[model samples]
Target: MEEVFIAHGGCPHWGKMPTRDASYLREQYPHFGGFLAQRKAVDPDGILLYGHLREMLGL
Candidate 1:
């Protein structure tokens, strides 16, 4: 897989093709952070083992 870095509120051209913001990138950090944290818990041997950790931390 290849990753491309583009600045927010900016655009890049590819052979006369234009890529524009489609409201995919959210302005809130907590939303995306929560997503990753959820995925992390589903990980093997993750913090979900701890009962309190899952309830309080949502890890």
Candidate 2:
């Protein structure tokens, strides 16, 4: 239940299923999955998350 209120990508708009799109982000970086906490714990450098954890992290 606590996970429901937790912020995934520093905001709630990212949703429970974000995508690896090439679209332009006005403020945050497009591929900035680095900001995600879960992604950081597994792969702080973001090398592994791109292929393995993208779906899990909703990014």
Candidate 3:
């Protein structure tokens, strides 16, 4: 799973691409982070998980 995320170049934190790679992902897959904010907006859950993943991955 970790390798999959890294291979896809996604942040693995929010399951979204990083800011540096966001533009490219946007152009390639416009819906990349579209649901991120919406997901957060709907439910504030997983915030801690995201942070943990980010920290664990050293991203």
User: RMSD of each candidate?
Assistant: 13.0, 8.6, 7.1
lDDT of 1 at 21: 27
Return the TM-score for each candidate structure. Answer: 0.26, 0.23, 0.30
Candidate 3 residues 1-59, lDDT tens each? 65676578744354553443444444555675765466557766755546544443333
Question: Of 1 and 3, which scores higher on lDDT?
Answer: 3
Better of 1 and 2 by TM-score: 1
lDDT tens digits, residue span 1-59, model 2: 32453335443344344333323232346455545655578776767655424554446
lDDT of 1 by residue, 1-59 (tens): 01243545343342333333223323423375666566586875664445543433334
Off by over 4 Å in 1: 1-30, 44-59
User: Residue 26 CA error for candidate 3 (Å)?
Assistant: 1.0
Report the lDDT of model 2 for residue 58. 49
**Rank order by TM-score, top first?**
3, 1, 2
Please, what is the whole-model Cα lDDT of each candidate in the order they appear? 0.42, 0.47, 0.50
